[model samples]
Target: MSQAAADTMDNTHAAEHGGHHGEHHVLPYTVYFAVYGSLLVLTGITVLVSFAGLGKWSIPVAMAVAVVKASLVVGYFMHLKYDDRLNSLILVVTLLFILIFFAMTFSDMRTRGMIDPVEDNMVLRNEQAAEKAAAAEASGESSEKGEEAHHEGAAEH
Candidate 1:
C-alpha cells in the first residue's frame, strides 16, 4: 500500500479502537455531579462534627472525612480507578509512607516526658493558684463586712 493509504489506515484503526491506547475513561456528567454532591455532604458533616464538640476526636474526624473526599476526587475526577494498576499502586504506597511519618511524629509527641518529667505542665498549678486567690479574697470580704457593721452600730448609738 502507498504511504498515504498506510497513514489513513492507522488513523482509521485508532478511531475504530479506543482513542489514545484505551487509557481514557469517558465519564458522564451525572457521575461528576454525584461525586461533587458527595464531597459537599462530607464537608457539611465535617462542619457539624466540629460544632458537635467531639473535643480530642475532632481532628481525627476531620482528617477521616478529608481522606474520603480526596479518595473520591482521585478515583472519579482524576479517573485513577479506571487507570493502570501501577498508578494505583504508586498512590497507595505514597499514602502508606505518609501515614507512617505522621504516626512517628505523634508517637514522639506523646512520649516526650519519658526521659524526664515535663516542668511546664502548668495547668494544674495555675488552677491551684486561682483557687488560693479566690479563698483569700473571700476572707477579706468577710472582714470588710464586719467593719462595715461595726461602723453602722457606732453611728446608731
Candidate 2:
C-alpha cells in the first residue's frame, strides 16, 4: 500500500479504538517536587511528635499526618485526582473498611483483660483479695488479722 493510504488506515484504526492518538497527560515537575517536599515535612512532623511526649495523642496525630501524606501521594503521584470519580469513591470505601477493621481489632484487644475468665490469672486473684479486704472492713474486722489467718490456713494445707 502507499504511505498515504497506510497513514489513513492507521488514523482510521486509532479512531476506532478510543481515539488515544499517542496522547497522554503529563504532570508538571513542580507538582512532583511539591508532593515530595510535603512528604518530607510530614515525616519530620511525625518524628517530632514522637519525641514531644504527646503520650496518648501521639499515635492519633501521627496517623492523621500519615493519612494526609498518603492522600497527597495517591492524588498527585498516583494521578487518582484526575482519574474517574468512581475510582476515587472506591478508594474511599476501601479506606473506610480498613479503618473499621482496625477499630474492631483494637477494641477487642483493649477489652480482652476486662472479659477474661475469673479463673484465668492473677488479676482475678488480686480482685478477690481486695473484695475480701473490703468485706472484712465492712464487718468491723481487721484486714491484717484476716490475712494472717488466711496465710495460716494455707500453711496448714
Candidate 3:
C-alpha cells in the first residue's frame, strides 16, 4: 500500500502494521475550533437564559444547552464518536439511568407534601394556621378564644 493510503487507517489492522497505533483518531484543527466555538455559544445561551426570566422554562432550556455542550465535548474531545459502538451504547445507557434517577427523585420530592400534608408541608400548615388566626381576629372574635382553642387542641394531644 502507498504511504499516504497506509496512514489513513486507524483500526487494529492498521495498528498491527505500526500505523496510527497509538492515535485512534486525528481530527484537523478546524474540528476542534468548531467544537470549542459551539461550547462557547452554548454557554452564552445558558447565561442569557438565566437572565431572560424564562421562569419555569429556564431549567429545561439550560439543561438542553448543557446536554448539547456535553455531547460535543464527549464526541469530539473524548473521541467517543469515533470509538467503538459498544462504548457509545454503554455511555448512552448510563446517562439514561441517571436521567431516570433524577426524574424519580424529583417526582418523590414533589409528592411528599401530598402524601402527608400536615407533616411534610410544615410551612404550608403554619401559613394556613396563621391565616385562620388572622380571620378570627378580623371577625372580632376574642383573642382569648383563639388561645383557648389552641391550648385545648394541644391538651388533646
Better of 1 and 2 by TM-score: 1
Candidate 1: regions farther than 4 A off = 1-20, 117-157
Candidate 3 local Cα displacement, residue 130, angstroms: 23
What does candidate 3's lDDT look like per residue over 1-157, in tens digits?
Answer: 2442343344434444545435656666677887899899889989988999999998989989998999999987897765666678899999899999999999989866655444655566677888988888999998888889999999999
* CA lDDT of every candidate: 0.75, 0.77, 0.77
Residue-wise C-alpha lDDT for candidate 1, range 25-120, written one tens digit per residue: 555567688889999999999999999998899999999999999999998788676566667889999989999999999998876644334555
Candidate 3 residues lying further than 4 Å off, grouped into runs, are 1-23, 117-157
Which runs of model 2 end up more than 4 angstroms from their true locations? 1-23, 119-157
Native-to-model Cα distance after best TM-score fit, residue 8 in candidate 3, in Å: 12
TM-score of each candidate? 0.59, 0.57, 0.59
Residue range 1-157, candidate 2, lDDT tens digits? 2553454455445444655435443556766887899999999999988999998998999999999999999977886655555678899999899999999999989867865475566576677888977888899887788889889999999
The predictions' CA RMSDs to the true structure, in order, are 17.5, 11.9, 9.2
